[model samples]
Target chain A: MQRYFIDTAMTAAPGTTVTLTGEIAHHIVRVMRMAPKDKVELVFPHQQAYVAELTQTTPTVAARLIAQLSFNSELPVAVTIACGLSKKDKADWIVQKGTELGAQAFVFFASTYAIAKWDPKKQVKKLERLQKIARDAARQSHRLVVPEVRYQKNVTALCQLPKDQGVVAYEEAAKAGETAQLVQVTQQLKPGQRVIGVFGPEGGFAPQEVTQLNAAGFTTVGLGPRILRAETAPMYYLSALSTILELQTPVVQSAYSE
Target chain B: MQRYFIDTAMTAAPGTTVTLTGEIAHHIVRVMRMAPKDKVELVFPHQQAYVAELTQTTPTVAARLIAQLSFNSELPVAVTIACGLSKKDKADWIVQKGTELGAQAFVFFASTYAIAKWDPKKQVKKLERLQKIARDAARQSHRLVVPEVRYQKNVTALCQLPKDQGVVAYEEAAKAGETAQLVQVTQQLKPGQRVIGVFGPEGGFAPQEVTQLNAAGFTTVGLGPRILRAETAPMYYLSALSTILELQTPVVQSAYSE
Candidate 1:
């Protein structure tokens, strides 16, 4: 079923009307052409969901409640992807794929190796646009939480985020049989624990750059024996991380203590 | 150092003249502006490498061997990816990625779900082009083995490959976790044992399609939680499978050996 995200409290009462506006309204009314009485699934940012029937399709696309049905699609571990803002379509592809792989947040920081530069005047507006892309990607992928897209203005400022479990994805990660960083990560991480996975630009993270991350409590981890491109690494690790924590492990108590 | 693959027997010899041609030649001679006597690494398939010097250039590219370098980059297990071809660019991407990920061979099979079709008479020629792309990818990725690229003609014929392992990568595998069908695959596979991985269309593998594969020798394996795109699934599993077997096990001496 086509799914949408709403901020409202979900109610099970049948026939209760709910209205959707903004881009989502346009998506349902103009793009999808969902007619009256067609079924759609929607959720709030919370773990609540409602299956609804389209009752009105006017200035605002509206739907009536069918039942409250909630199932979890979020990753067991909260994965945050931090990358040097890449150019054009590569950045967009990374955000979309990262969201699909269940990244809880995305950090696009300007780095020394970063080739793409954002105009100072439009930085916030650009981020707002990227935020919408992440939201739509999360909705399209049936994710419980929309991945947050943050533009970290600069690397020094980027350094200030709370140091949770951190790993810098650099080539220096040993593949000569040291428990392969990926295997070590999967075995150690539990559900609900968030990991900050750092990705570099096309030029890769400089040796000094990785040293700075190392100083900030991030351990360098390799994906595998081969070299994956910048855009490819984040998706690769995120999928690998999500696979072990979300898909492989049986349902247990939440890893996120919050 | 510049790298190129040469089909010379003397790459195994201590000192022999070898030529780098085509793109590698243009890249070294023109783009890199490499000087004469500059050291470069050249690999000969199924043999050792030569640390060669750029002795000659111009319209033709040639190098003289200096020493035998024992550096080898081969994955422990050889994998083959069989996907229903998507767009022209997608076929190229898969081959390139499959090379980097250490695939031994590739097959673009016709399937029930494939919307893209090549002229039947052109199968040999189209696959020849794909084979070239795979060869180029192998050279670029520094793969010792340039994976074979061929047209499988049809799914049934492709699935008939008598291998120790056959896997149909289905989204259903994610939810089906730990089922009798999926649990033993990783545990049973070994290095040098050829495994076949099948992927479906963008529309996804149908239930009956799953049934067809199951009826074949193909074993269905899950690639983790989120739904991977048709292109991503083959890679995701190939990487995952590589990690499970090659990266971790010291010398796989399977515990399953009776």
Candidate 2:
């Protein structure tokens, strides 16, 4: 069944009728052409998911809630992928793929060696485009939450964000043979903890940028021995996190099983 | 420093001269615009990487071997990513990214639900293009080996490929909440073992296909709960392998450290 993220809060009680309007209604009525009694998932605020059967498709689109869903696809620990702004569609690619891979949020910041500069005039438009991509990817991946996309002016501003732990992906660290930090840090994380992983652009981070992040309490770590591209690093980080946190754990009643 | 995979076997001892011609020479001379005495890393056929300095740049390009490097960037276990042929540039994307993530080989096979079809006349040319992509990605990522790209006619042909272990990435297995197989299989893998991971296309596999693979001694594994696109699943698999095999192990002298 197709899933939609409903923006508003709805009663959690079963058998309640929920009406969807605007883009959601248009998608259900025109795009999907879902008929009465057809089932679709509606995820409300606070990550509550439900199975709902369509009651009407013409004039208005509405569905009657069936039962609350028990399984969640969100990562056990929330991850914020903070990267230096990159050129062209690289950011777009990152957001789309990152959402599917289970990142809780994304942050793009300016750095000394970053090739792409975000224009002040068009920054909102650019962010809106990325936000839309995240939404679409989240829906396609059956995720209950759409990751928020944000921008910071520079590395200092990025460092100000609150996180339980922060790790900067420095090539020099990898080059120096610092292979244990990533595994060490990820292994210690408990459920509900937030982590921010900082990555560089095509040209990589300037030495001082790494120093500043280090001063601000970010540990320097390497993804692996092979040098991953700027965009590829984040995917590697997320995948590693999933492997460590999710796949390595004992089996549970998962989202898909429901 | 840049790296190139030299196709032929060369003298591994230092203080020897290696000649470069054709595309590799063109890239070093014309694209990089290197002068005499500039250093570059040349990887020989047996995965021996050596630091060499340019001797001439005119009618011929030659380099004198400086020293033999001890670091190895290839994954501890050789991994072959076998995916159902996807449409457009998805295969190209997979080969490039997968190579960087440390896949030793890639195989694209025709499957029941695959939308893309490869013409027999153009198959060889298509493999050449993917092979080139793997080479470029391997060089960019400083890998010692360029992953071989191959094509299989069907699932049976894919299963017949030699491997110490075979895993089929099934969404149904994920949906059924079978999450322990991937970790169990990967945890038992010893260094130098060969493993093949098979993935489906956008439409996924037919029931019979899964049964066929299961009967062939391929274990069904779930990557994670979230749904990954046809192109994205291979990356996830490779990244997970790197995480479990490389990051989770005790620290040692790594390739980048050299």
> Which number leads on DockQ?
2
Please provide, for model 1 over B131-200, each residue's C-alpha lDDT reduced to its tens digit, 9 standing for 90 to 100: 8887776665556677888887777788687677788888766655433333246546665678888898
CAPRI tier of model 2 = acceptable
Give me the runs in candidate 2 sitting further than 4 Å from their true place: A249-258, B249-258
TM-score of chain A of each: 0.87, 0.95
Model 1, residue B196: C-alpha shift (Å): 1.2
Interface RMSD of 2: 9.2
| Candidate topping TM-score | 2
Q: Model 2 lDDT vs. the true structure?
A: 0.88
- Candidate 1: which pairs clash? A191-A255, A192-A255, A192-A256
Clashes of each: 3, 0
* Best model per lDDT: 2
| lDDT (Cα, 0-100) at A251 in candidate 1 | 23
Residue B92 in candidate 1 has what lDDT? 78
The per-residue C-alpha lDDT of model 1 at residue B30 equals 85
> Considering summed lDDT, which 10 consecutive residues are worst modelled in model 1 chain B?
B249-258
For model 1, the stretches where C-alpha displacement exceeds 4 angstroms are A8-16, A174-179, A247-258, B7-11, B58-60, B67-72, B121-129, B175-183, B249-258
Candidate 2: tens digits of C-alpha lDDT, residues A210-257 = 999999989999888999999999999999888877775433422211
Error of 1 at B177 (Å): 5.8
